[model samples]
Target: MVLPPLRRLLRTAAWLLLFAALGALGLLLVRAFEARGKPDLMPWHRIVLAQELSADTLDARSTWADVLAREQQVFDDLHAQLAAAAVPGEFRYERGSRIGARAGERDGNRSFESMPAEPRGGVLLLHGLTDSPYSMHALATIYERAGFAVIAPRLPGHGTVPAALLDVRWQDWSAVVRIAMRELRARVGADAPIHIVGYSTGGALALDYALDALDDARLPAPQQVVLVSPMIGLRPFASLSRWLPLYGRFDYFEKSNWIDILPEFNPYKYNSFPANGALQSYLLTARLRGRIATRAAGGNLARLPPLLAFQSVLDSTVSSADVVHALFDRLPANGSELVLVDVNRASLLAPMLRSAAAGQIDVLRGTKPRAYRLDIIGNLRADTLDVGEQRYDPGSRVPVERPLRLAFPSDVYSLSHVALPFPCDDPLYGTTPRADEDYGIRLGTLVLRGERGALQVSAEQLQRLTCNPFFTYLEERVDAVLR
Candidate 1:
């Protein structure tokens, strides 16, 4: 009887061991399957959607030049498709409107009068880093119609050549603003309440001016300030450089890779400067914030002006929250207001918070202690921002679905980063009416439309539209407040 019982126990132990081995094998298989299913190694063509073909056209063609000329031809076709889908009459150019000026032109002063005057206060439009004043032409036209004199000045090393940007420092760009500010003051008088509007890095510079030099005896503080998608901090990708020593040593190490990454959106790839240029921008922003903090600590809040900032939560390019937090921390108590504009409120991602459990979506969290009233606006397009992760399938041999979201909040405002210098209805592309007259209007309305169907324009919008672009939402809010 003892021998039989022992034999059964031995068989049970053997069976248990076999089950454990099978379980381990299954786990290995699952991990291997997941690895094979990874999105890595997928063809670049298959990674991006058909729509990205146009946005990536310039980069794809230029970068793949080493591969074959056929690649360039393919991207060229994609570019044509993008142009066709773009808003009608949006990209046309006006007659006799020169884009870039040759150096040492004697007729430079003669053409000053070419820009039309408006009824509102004068506007000083500044472009972002690696960009020119040409980006502000379209928005500038809108300001002109709204009755404001617009001056879209090209920053140092920009609009001339890309190589010039290599040697250009942050101060050099700031100097250009100083000159433009002086000119605007001369044109509109010291107390005419000049409004300063900046895009991207330009917006950061504008904020710096407000913090550092606005109250200087040499130039009057701007009557109002507007920042669109300001670059206040290094993007998430920059975080990696902190860990890699090689990334810190070679400033230009990532330049080549970054240039090739997004060609169509960043046409200035050929003109990329040393990586130090980016470092300089980073340093300048840091210094600006430090200076503001120092001043606030010393109780010197009188120098800062009432400021308004507009940032798109879906922007893949800049940290919208960083800009707001930096400004919010430095601003005098109740001196500034923050506006968080949701450009993706209408897409599949419209109710973004609901999808958070899926690990594909997130909200902009304000780092500062203060709570900002968030105003979500649905964009004219599908309203979804392509975070890129959900659509990127590395294992798939075929192309992924294209991400369809506006590039920036201003893009919804009928202004491209490069076209803010000209009028909204400028004849550059043609005098034809755009099919979507309500493009920005819808966005503007959504911004004011609040819970319980109440429409109250936030304080930030009031400051932005004071001397520049006029939003009907702002007008209605002001009227209601007055009543």
Candidate 2:
């Protein structure tokens, strides 16, 4: 039996909880209503072109030919539907437009193979969510030049409309990775080495595949797994996104399905982000975290392959600490390495950094014993922008400092989540786009100065650094791994 005063307090608390729930619902509806006046939904958002394959179809039995056929059908439908239904606009869906997907490589949005005569090995390149095979194009060239046959696959539901993300499951993505791995294994044969290079969500997929390979002998394990800004974990809010889409099931609240409905400006990537996309990512990472824990507890992770990961110290997209605590800390004494691109401490903006952000390097360099090597790339001193590498070997706190012929650009405060993959001379997102190649639009070259309400996208999105200044260093490190 409860006391009378306690019962009264409990009743009041229940009422307050109900009111808070109601308030949140009201706010969501208000935002949905406001989105109705933003921009009309394009054909790409509404149409699902390649509707043939299911998660069941994307299994070990499936061939790369089948995936390519489905991809071809998708692009065909996209070209036809957009040409007929889509109006001539400045957006990417416009047919034959400069910024359109069709204006680029004939097969830019699909899975592609780069073969070198008498290849030494094979490489499987997987891109991020909402990003097409074009994201791996530059890296493919690097591997190809080094005499490796490269297979960069456009993951299921990606390189197409943002609406396609709504129906796709993380399992479908995993199956696709398996199929691609089999293809690369076949191409390179049984003796030759095979590697996986994953960026963002692809990084999660790569690591998950590696973990699965530990238990399953049928799977082909990678020689080395390379990750860039891997999605090892997501914020707590992403898990809650699953419930918000309940209202979106109704036609009246369709706008609520999208987190952002920005114009599809980039040809290779989706500007608009959907609620299901976030939900799927959270589910994938959550399951991955659990798998890592289970494997570590069982000591099955000892056989796991060496992993080489590159991450920014302050990433806006994924949790950097999760990379350290969840994955790296649990590893065995394999030759795994983590390269953290630290903030430009010599920058004038250094003083403006948040207290937590400023202290991140110290947190990463804690006295705890680590199983893997840790390398931090940043300023050597507070007074100069000259960069150097600080190498911390396994179980060692003392760092061996090596000066590099590199320096942070005076204007750049830090590298971003999206910047580590591409070189400075990249045609699409380079600070100085190559004069030879044209991708219709050079996003990295834009320096806009206008009023706040002038653009649909935020000013911050345009101002974010898109390409890496230290890409040469990244390339050399990867090349050394290949050698």
Candidate 3:
């Protein structure tokens, strides 16, 4: 029934679409060839090898001292392996050049370090994926100053080469956490209260462990739980991340990964992330949610401790909405709280905010009594840059506002998922460190003024804010909880 001219136009458009799909697939195939042949970048460098790192075994759990010793031994192996495999002058794998230790000392960040003294209580700090004890160093210092003996373990598959994460599963991370908790309890005794602080992927582990403890009396229970940008849930695409490995099955696409591999420039965090890491994190979160439902059905949720969660409104990593619905909303009225850091409304970037971030504070407390408190740290007014706390008390619909001393940095639009743990003056990530104990690289003060693509790392990396302007408030809130 269609006219000849209209039918001819439709057929031509279909042909164009088919050609475009073929062109995209052809480009991917060409990319695989390019990646596999690059000398500075290789599959082995990115691939996970099975030599059984300390993070892969339960035998490392003798004592804190023994666990640290084993971790160092594993690092030694990684160093040797990297040295042997690295191409000359390649900064990614080179141990003592631009990317790693400068003073010939083993990377202090790769090993476990504690700020232990006469302690009032015990606090265990768990870092995120591809991060080490270094991520928690600033927070550990805060806990140390507050008379809390802090134990920040270098999670297995971290604090070493990027390839270390390839072979590691979620169980390995949970195992190390159990060992760390046992050591903390042994040091501080059973009667004294113990608190657990987790960031990103570590947050999932903390919630999972706490849920297990509720069911099992043998596992140690945290008196309180604090999460920073917790990974309670991820994007739906993460569930299918396991299929990513199938791409490597073909010879032409052997080097192809879920994400394009990059150089490792950052000392504390691995600049190169693996597909397996994402898959494990997704599986762990799935298990965590399933367990939460199981516990809720039995009316055993009352055993959960108070949870203080700090989430960014415009997070690209974890779901900010899930922080409210899946985790905090399910709590049984045990004085839990959710602190959301709103995007900078006063900045030029304010209009660029996604709809989710613009209405981030409206997570459903209207005309209803919620079990927990909701505190939003954001602008005092839409017209002003001044920041304050909008506190919604438990069971109250109306929020009480309190102005604070802090204000948003004019240039920074919003806090990132990783920025929550670091302060403005942190040695590596800070713009200015409160004290100068160097890790050889002071990335926080970097302000490069040059042509585009001049730096070795990406512009996207440089643009993301590394330090938190409101860190003093974070410290005060945490200190109050400790007291």
Query: How would you encode candidate 2's per-residue C-alpha lDDT over 1-483 as one tens digit per residue?
Result: 999999999999999999999998888778677656657666777777665455787766789888888878877887677778867766677754677443344556788897777888999998998888887877787788789989998888888788888778888888888888998988888988999999999999999999888878899889889999999987778887776666777777787787788888787899988888898899999999999999888887988889999999888889998998899999999999999998998999999988898889888777897899999999999889999999999999899999989999998999998888988888888889997777578888889887898999999898889898988888888888889
Top model by TM-score, which number?
2
Off by over 4 Å in 1: 1-120, 236-274, 333-335, 343-346, 349-374, 378-483
Runs of candidate 3 exceeding 4 Å displacement: 1-56, 59-62, 86-92, 101-108, 111-117, 249-252, 363-367, 433-435, 438-440, 448-458
Clash pairs, candidate 3, are: 425-432, 425-433
Worst 10 residues of 2 by lDDT: 100-109
> Mind giving the per-residue lDDT tens digits that candidate 1 earns over 1-483?
569889999999999999997876665444444433322221121122222112122331232122124323434544354444443221111122223223363211110212345234567788776665544544454456555666775554444323344445677667656666666666665555677878778887887887656456656578667666676775655433222222322433323222111111122111233344465567667787687777778878665665656554544456655665556545664434444444333344344434532221234533224422323332334533322112212222232333323233332322222222222232222122243332111112223333552423333332221111223322232222112
Please give the lDDT score at residue 257 for candidate 3.
49
Best by lDDT: 2
For candidate 1, the per-residue lDDT at 312 reads: 46
Off by over 4 Å in 2: 1-31, 34-38, 50-52, 100-106
Query: Global CA lDDT of candidate 2, please?
Result: 0.85
Q: Is candidate 1 or candidate 2 better by TM-score?
A: 2
Q: Rate residue 34 of model 1 by lDDT.
A: 40
After TM-score superposition, the amount by which residue 163's alpha carbon in candidate 2 deviates from its true location, in angstroms, is 1.8
How should the candidates be ordered by TM-score, best one leading? 2, 3, 1
